[model samples]
Target: MSENGGRRSQAQRDAITVEIGYALFSGAFAAAVVFGAFAGPALLFELPGGLETLLLRTGLVVAPVLFVARVVSVLLRFRQSPQPSQPGRTSPDS
Candidate 1:
């Protein structure tokens, strides 16, 4: 155990921050892509107003669900991964 007891080191905190940013960026990107895919035909073609509205509405609902799922999956994977050895640490095999 370290002197800080259960507290994470600065490097650990930095890793978490980076992971969080990565998750958010990727989630937003996924959401945008999903929305574009769903509503692109409506936007590009001359669809009826009702159909266009339906497509847009479906996209609006689906995008956020994807965003949340993306974020959760990424963060969960990051959390489950093994942490790297700290600086100046030696493995037992060494």
Candidate 2:
């Protein structure tokens, strides 16, 4: 393959990786929200005993915190990424 072709392929792979990362993050956040919303109320009202209570309470606290951290990390990484050049414009680095 030609040099430019290789670069284009690499760029496509990178783009796909970023997209998958975003999708996974979105799924994680959604799961966290669903679990927290459903379980929080149930735990508050029903009051499970022993290990079940500990597990549910731990999940209630951990899931949202982890989701927020994942979001922040993704945002920071996204901000740090360079913008793609327009079709007609030469990249500044080139």
Candidate 3:
């Protein structure tokens, strides 16, 4: 019996893909909050009462899109990668 405990599966790879997506979302959301609170004034045109509405709104809308973009990039990378295969091996059935 193999140490795999059973047949190996791609569940591990799928789970990692999901985790990366979540991480991207979290990081973008955090960045939005930080920028809106601290750096928004400098990065955006000065507004009334020293507030930058455009930066805040832009962050709220863009964060999720950025998260999706990151996920797409990861999936593309996964597709482009080559899988390791046994050399000089062929099934008897073939």
- Kindly indicate the candidate among 1 and 3 with the higher lDDT: 1
TM-score leader: 1
Ten contiguous residues minimizing lDDT sum, candidate 3 = 78-87
lDDT (10s digit) by residue, model 1, range 1-94: 2468788888888988999999999999999999999899899999999999999999999999999999999999998987757667867887
Report the C-alpha displacement of residue 29, candidate 2, in angstroms. 3.4
Task: Give lDDT tens digits, candidate 3, residues 1-94.
Answer: 2248965457656656676777677667765665565546646666664356555666667766665666667666755665445447765666
Candidate 2 lDDT score at position 34: 59
RMSD of each: 3.4, 9.6, 8.0
Instruction: Report backbone clashes per prediction.
Output: 0, 0, 0
Give model 2's TM-score versus the native structure: 0.46
Pairing residues by index, what is the TM-score of model 3?
0.44
Q: Once model 1 is optimally superposed onto the true structure by TM-score, how far is the C-alpha of residue 73 displaced, in angstroms?
A: 0.5
State the local distance difference test value for candidate 1. 0.92
lDDT of each: 0.92, 0.68, 0.62
Which window of 10 residues has the lowest lDDT sum in candidate 1? 82-91
| Models ranked on lDDT | 1, 2, 3
TM-score of each: 0.83, 0.46, 0.44
Model 2 clash pairs are none
By TM-score, the candidates rank as 1, 2, 3
Q: Which stretches of candidate 3 lie over 4 Å from their true place?
A: 1-51, 86-94
